[model samples]
Target: MNDAQALLPEAIWRDRIFNGDWIPALGGSHTFTEPATGEQLGRVGLANADDVTRAAGEARAAQAAWAATDYKERAGVFRRAALLLSKHHNELSTWIVRETGAIRPKADLELREAGAHLLEAAAMLTQPKGQLLASASNQLSIARRVPHGVVGVISPFNFPLILSIRSIAPALATGNAVVHKPDLQTPVSGGVLIARVFEAAGLPKGVLHVLPGGADAGQAMCTDPHIAMIAFTGSTAVGRSIGELAGRHLKKMSLELGGKNSLIVLDDADPDIAAANVAWGAYLHQGQICMASGRILLQRGIADAVIERVVAKARNLPVGDPAGGAVALGPLINARQVQRVHGIVEDSVAAGATLLTGGSYERQFYQPTVLTGVLPGMRCFEEELFGPVASITVFDTDDEAIALASATSGCLALGVITPTLARGMRIADHVPAGHVHINDQTVLAEAHAPFGGGGTSGNGGRHGGAADWDEFTQWQWMTIKTEAPRYPF
Candidate 1:
């Protein structure tokens, strides 16, 4: 039994499957290290453009049979896989913590979200496929949904489990084969683990192929003729390029990109409660999430009190290795990410933001930083820092608050904390973020809820719930005629 304590460090996670065979990666391999300890965990095979071509071709050939399979059979695969994921959470989470630099709780949350994704996909299979339509007399007409053949999924390092699973599970459940490219930094948790669970659950070969790869493989997937769609979750710049590629290829695409989300503390809010929410929203997983509260808007009346409370929490939260579950925050992904995070903070400080309690780092573990006097044009308020830096900007009235909220590339999430729920709702109505939270924090997620972003954050495509069918399938209108007498055309 592979439990948390019994798991060994040297266990290599080498998985690169094409078609039904386990083949060596022609693009060479990459070695991964535990971010907390800098210890070499394992190596993963990297794929090239040729490998993507081969994988997409095989997956395209396999998608027809998978789509024609009985709906019960398809639903069963997800059910069993969901149970298997839960059963193997202990072992998989060990790898998650070491591979992704996530704390135990965060690792567990990923596992739970993954399992929920599978279960939700299973239920989706049995839902109404299409709706009855009104047609001419003496004729029956219906509109139905059809799979998009093969889908290519590209995911990043942070929250690998759900980020990849969100697309993979739904695509497969809806009868589309998948060619997945997980970040080379976290292949095991992102790609290999999903493949293993589905394979164990009796999914046929070639229906799902996970290839740990680089930019070439990703671009190949985007341009590959056999692939019908692309689902990507990462930085905005990469997403924009992929969107362009998908557009050129005329392939269906879903891009969940970056955000510098805002959490607004209204004048009537309880400062202590609002501060707690801000701290959690900004610092969870070292502020690596796309929905992390990078900008905190404080109403001028309660600005000072909330800032003090937030500073105390920032100071008290411990940042270190998360293996033992003692640390509140774990290390950043690596030295490069740490440098990027610190560079953002340094730039923000230089741009007139006052560093309050924390702005330094000990190796990869960045301090839980809090900054004040942040304005619209400052780097901290403008760009998605993607680090544990809470930049607070003060606003006087509702008009000013709404203007501040609307003035950004950040459009993923907006949170407003107010004693009056109606006021919170009123404020939320003016914001253009895809997700709005009243009396809560910015980072909010549910497997059954519709999720995506606005403006730079997304291209108006949504994930989860009814959005799955719209994303993974194309609409087909069918009409039945009783006799040979048809339209004049």
Candidate 2:
């Protein structure tokens, strides 16, 4: 088959699920569109409670066989899926760019990173971490990772492919059956794409199922008795709702939620590096990322020089067609996002904050905005903007900067800019965020470290280690005495 045909065959969804191979949802469908451009792409089922039940039933039935499968065999499937992803990289990239409006390089990066993650997952599954023995009598039992019976995954729009696959790989690697409810806005990239990869890897039909729809679908899956865990990535509002439901049901959950992250710059920091880094963090993906550095704290002595450098850096970011390769910034996901961003900027400007550079939105595009003299009352300073808007504030002391950064309730990630290691260590020690980078932009990792938030960010858990893959699983300990007891005689 040709590459296009191989990637998404005609009636593929129907063939896979609607047919006898799997159970189909009875709910209605909605048309999917590209966020950057209002182009119609495809349709996804807005599943109902019955749909969720059916999926859960199938997953419960499938879990035993999946759990019994050897880890190496499971790892082999992921390896093959990674190879397939790389083979069809462009096709996947095109779909991601069209559906999510990620620039070509960024889209490609996500795709490649996803493939790499899968490869890493394969290795991790093959050699999961074991428990260290603490004492002879106690046996310091550390059960290796074993999958939950049924895991329900709810992914976000901003990072459909990467996030969805990130959860799926480990869940399946540890032998859990999964019911994935992808974001309605980008179902093709998140839900449909992942299903195909699992199918290509010859994963059992009911091991991984995708219900591409809205909140009701998610609510149904979250409340379902068959679901043992719920892995969610989205806004703090919705995340709290999920957390509540999960808590009510007492299901294991990993919540990667919201953030109003800050970028702190010290007096000795490099103005050029600091400015460029903040601009990139604020503008990349139109600042839709939870980890986006929305608040910028600068030492009073260097605020002017840093602001000038930031303005210079902001001038170079081109906003246009993401696939065109020239643009650095793309359109916000939709009209709601545009209004949300505009409202924050307007509120900040109205609250006596000074506008430094860009703060205007043209159509779906919002300008790379910079604001100074920010106060805690302004929306940008108080809430997570999730847009290409940066608020720069002057602080007289490290204590003042740390206090300001901690003022907001949200604490997923933060960036620290300092000239000396001593000062960076101090800031790092004091910062409340789960992830802190010294003298760099706020960015997430695809491998080799933990990536999630604190407080509102997520439950404390590492993602890149074998221990993480084990977290998706459960443990069983068995022991035997080699020597017979004298009482037996």
Candidate 3:
């Protein structure tokens, strides 16, 4: 049996959670193998468009009661969910590590982040849902937040647990029913476990539905009139497609798309400190995160020093099956991802980028690669390589650095390394991004922070804190009077 199978009960990874009950998939079951071992871990039901319509209908029916539930009571459900996630961390973490090929630490990070979001959502429920408004003529007038009724959330494989929860928990907390489609690759951690947690937390029946599906289900979610909003986290290509569909359907969209982020090293920065930050940003989670640093820009004065230290770090890093033993890096999600990553490296080399180290892979375990002399147009510098490769391009002036960072709209998150706070902040502001960091790496986010990017990164919609109210709820104006006014005409 695979580690995932050994860790989970046969029933834990069901195909779908429909109207609060686990059911066999309507479309069929899809086999899921552990990427680390290539062993068949288990299977889950693949939901189809029919299932999406049924699930959305059920959610629509349940939304009214859920929305009317006391805010405190709604908060209580998620509060319990947070504790339940903590209580079952061991089992959930194993599913994440084995299924997603995430290192143990990264798996733990997913659990921690997911739990925090649940807690944040609990607090969000009790926040003021409406506010009194001053009107020109009315005696009493108010503007209030109301649930969107039904929200469709589509999550990706990378960082499945947290990415799924960041949208799901808030949508549920704010009194919207949810129909979720988890990426096929990591259904257990992304969908099944979340359903289990919410079920155990006493979430009402038909309030949430978890569907492990593909394009058909996602398409249904986007076009389903009953689903008022669609929250998606995935590649730029897919996000754009979904955004188009949502627009045509006149549905609200929260899209967190991919990024070819950058980490810039200034002349005055310490090479050791800067290199360590770059390595972490580029190689963490095998660089499968949207915020992972895809390009490294070093000023001429510190280029050699930083590149040398980065290359040394990359060469020394361990790569293997995360499930088998302790390794700094784990396999890619599958052979396809491995091929894509290697292809990018080869293409970049042909484009004149010097491969400093690591341009090979054994099975899915890709080596931590370091590339220097990478120009702006090369594949390594231009594309969002979701792999353990650090591609570097040296810059001469701040003007050139800003131009390089601004050349692409892939700056979902950006980092500038400089001890001079004023200089770093100024440079960061010049580059357009959802989030910016000075003296730090690119990949980092809190559960409660308003998260998303501008332009291709997303459409102004955000995913946490007050952004949740904006994303998952609509506004309405109300008026009340002690007596009915006579006709003024």
Candidate 4:
């Protein structure tokens, strides 16, 4: 058995709503299966409205105490949590690999990344980043970031550890109590890992609650009045529904939704670099990512050359067991995702598109696929595929490339590849996306840079980095009138 298998008890961690006490799921118990090997791993309780209420109540009651704790004290707890995560990263990584079908190296990176997030949050306490603006003669204006009270985080399974808890670290660091509902598919890996960190850090049990359930449970959490904010990362369709719900409640929300992201290759672009990075961006995780470069816009002059390079690279990518070091890729999360990707590929071929490489399927594993002669109206280009398929389009000029890149209604991320720095910067300016990368893929995420999309791609607000913490917080402005001014209104 791997370290993760050893650390996690063979007996599944049963779920009961945590409301200062454990109780049975409102519905009943359900079993969870590992996607990589279609074997039953464990069971989790399915929560209903009642459980959401109890969990919200528990979080609400603990909010004040957690908020009252000094920022430095809270940061110290985060530091301890970071230490604990680092110590047991290998175990957590192995769990992530088995549950989510993530390759060992990528899973290991996520483990360390989780610890890094906590450490970064701990460091932010020393520098609150709140500011004091210009003051009038009689008054001094100070702006402070206040917690949102309690936050509901609904995470997806694609990236169990990173996506699941990305919001939690910032929400907790900024004095907000978080109710985290990890995706049912990989709950054990994400939930167990974070729970250990919190326990080692000596956090109050109710400060952070992990509720494992399905969509109904997630809706309950969103609609709960006690939830002051909702931070969600998942499909665009689901994000739209949750966004509407949060809006009805008038709760603060941060959504990192779906992306029909694109990579633009200028006429002068280096085909080798563009092809290699774009292929990696699209096929990583079997192309199951929000910002996967689903669309490739190539300048007419070099379109054929770039296509040749991408086809060769795609042919070389190996798909096999995630546990094996030689494997460069793994299966999709489940049979449903596998079908979805394959269906899209079939539709593309039927629509008069040319398949350069891949397009074969074996169970959950999908060979990397590249398509050219794709039209804008196709589902692959119009909507987020959320799978490992790239639809290629050629453009006549830089203007045309930029237009094609931004043509999709969704614009979470965009990549620009150009030999000249000036042209790359120019193209990036026109593309409407939350995050833009030059000469690189859109998967790039930095701790300090704000992440999220603009337009139909996602909601208005962003997350991560210094700016993201402020997103979960409301500003409380205070003005002190020390002495009487000449003119007082």
Candidate 5:
């Protein structure tokens, strides 16, 4: 094997794919390092504006032929891809750990979910197309779901494999070509791995293109005329910018943005169970998930007991190199993320919030932190910390608890822990989040569930299962006249 193939184990890493062949990027390349060890891993070629245009053009050219192919044939490719993903799950998980600092279990989970996404997309092939409609006596009318031609997918760093494939699988299943731009921080685990899987599965050439680059490349994909839609998963700020550009060009856009989610513990709940769930939700993958619990709302009756339990749990969870051994938490993605998490914790403490435990950092590792007395106005309470920091706030009554949970402008996911399912259901109904869990934490996802939020959390774009096809395809209404129509002219 060549040196690049040995490092990546994927032949596509030698160059970016365009027109069904590997080609060098015009904008040179960038090097990425392992976040845990700060050691250089590999360099990914950068795609310039010209490169983006070419990818979109190629995808547009190939889309018509691919869409016209038999749906069963398309389904076969995804089935093979799913098998390939499972076959290479261990290697992909290791790369995920090295590139993104995810603990071993979390990395493994991401690969499993990635394979599930591919399988789910394959199942969508059996879903019925547009429904038959009632029409006049002489006219036959029906709605047909058609491919959008080409889709531009931009995925995030955390859970890179699952998130990127979440969009890629559906786009291909619906007979649309795709140009994918994975986060520059995790190209090997995210972009290259995906390209390798599909290529090995015998996916048609020029149907899917993987381009790894920074902001300029992403902007080019967003504004490219040949791209019929843009599906992005990232921060709200970036989503807003992409939304504006897509709107100007009248292109379809689906955004899964940031979250300031909440997890509420009621008075009747068991303190131990609630605390365990909170720790898992707030610290898993170092709280990098969009649905990670940012605020913990505790009823005054059980506030102190639950706080003590949560503190003890956080203190015992191991933190270190993810690849070394069993560890509950891993380092943040990079130095900037560490600095940002610490700054939020320090500023919250300065604003009169109490730091119950953890508030220390070394290099990219930040200890799992718990805070109390966090009021509504504090920065940590209002903003997204996106780390292993959980802010606790006590509520006097059920009304107050609901109010606190709904205070955030953006709602992605919410959790309610109550003694009875009735109470939990009632509280969950009032919250505006996309997903709600009873007697559980806010951080949860499945490959076949509708997984996007409302308000600022997303652009009403649903991903996964049958809902994803809405964003990847368009509905066209057609009518056939069996007789001459009578009209007044």
Candidate 6:
């Protein structure tokens, strides 16, 4: 419709890729519409079981050669890919904003972070590999890291660029070939643009394949014998299915799923700082983030002051078209997401939660919402709403606060806002989350950090920094003997 949108590939807008080339799907195509404007952007090819199987087979064929490549040469490809991503940041960010309804600032941040993540994956290549072991016998034993052959990467719609690359870059860096299945809602930015960037960086043919499709394609990838591992980022419900299927074949999986994250405001905290932190954590990108702070636990002594500040900030935040400029919030991904969020808010209010400031929507855009008097039994406090809504609950004592924060199906991240760092660390130690923040918010992530959750939030597979090498690879022990070893006859 515009100059920026015109840059999208017209020929392969409705195609899946195999062997580094776009091919039409035997299955019919699906049209993607802009969430904000409700205008049809373009049609995307829907990969069937056959398509996915072909992609996986090709990736398996390519993996051995790719793995044999020198680590430095592979690192060079990642570095060049990162540079190309940075150079095309504006175009990619525009694509993200158009398809995902992410505000300009959030979209820009995702693109920059995606490039940095690529560079981080490249740096991991230089890290020391598996180490020599201490043995009781007179034999030299060493464990070496080896690629998993073919990795199936399933990414979600929200934060498509970063989330997709979060696994893709690391899998490639580890010398594994990848077959990527991006969400159907984000075919342009998530699927096409990623392939182009790697293509420009001279990634070898068949090393990385981008196949855009839905459930059938995903299932095919999981069940494919050639796919040695699956890296998925999506809802817990789907993650469970993938894990089960992968487990049936004894295939490895790294899953980063949903969270009902909590942010605690201690009595000694500055109300303004606490409010600001919670606001960003709860409402950024319309709170579609996995680590979005859906539950806010405030100590009774400071509850009133923090609520007042938070309500004021939430009311004043901008909500409008992302492309219109300077808006703090934008539309949810689609109408179904809008209905889901609104239903959660209304049900929570009916169940005795008080709507503090905003609880209204116009089309796909829902106002930044805050709630008070949310108790443990209510859906708002218990469920992962994944919207621009923060439910506030007051705790009378430190033990009660900790209990309330830990009372969830699983923990991904938890935050403590306290006057003293020591108190924050003490509370953080008791929380079950993998990531704990002192005097910050729960929705914090870095490219090179060990980023994954414990319990239901993840399958105990970490996705970034050194953790990725472990997730995407397997260990093989090598042994050598200076003399013939004694054997039991």
Off by over 4 Å in 4: 1-7, 10-12, 16-24, 133-140, 481-489
lDDT of each: 0.88, 0.81, 0.89, 0.79, 0.88, 0.87
Scored by lDDT, model 5 comes in at 0.88
Q: List the candidates' TM-scores in order.
A: 0.96, 0.93, 0.97, 0.93, 0.96, 0.96
Candidate 2 residue-wise lDDT, 294-350, digit = tens: 889989988999899888777767888787668888889899989988888888899
Tens-digit per-residue lDDT, 12-47, candidate 5: 464453345567898888788898889988877788
Report lDDT (Cα) of residue 12, candidate 5. 49
* Candidate 1 colliding pairs: none
Q: Residue 247: error of model 6 in Å? A: 1.3
- Per-residue lDDT over 414-464 for candidate 6, one digit per residue giving the tens place of the 0 to 100 score: 999997887788788777897998889988888989899867798988978
- What candidate 6 gets wrong by more than 4 Å, as runs, is 1-8, 12-18, 135-139, 481-489
Name the candidate, 3 or 5, with the larger lDDT value.
Answer: 3
Q: What's the lDDT for candidate 3? A: 0.89
lDDT, residue 273, candidate 5: 93
RMSD of 1: 2.1
How many residue pairs of model 3 clash at the backbone?
1
Worst 10 residues of 4 by lDDT: 12-21
Q: How many Å off is the CA of 273 in candidate 5?
A: 0.4
Find the number of clashing residue pairs for candidate 4: 0
lDDT of 3 by residue, 86-141 (tens): 87778888889999999999999899999999999988866898899987565789
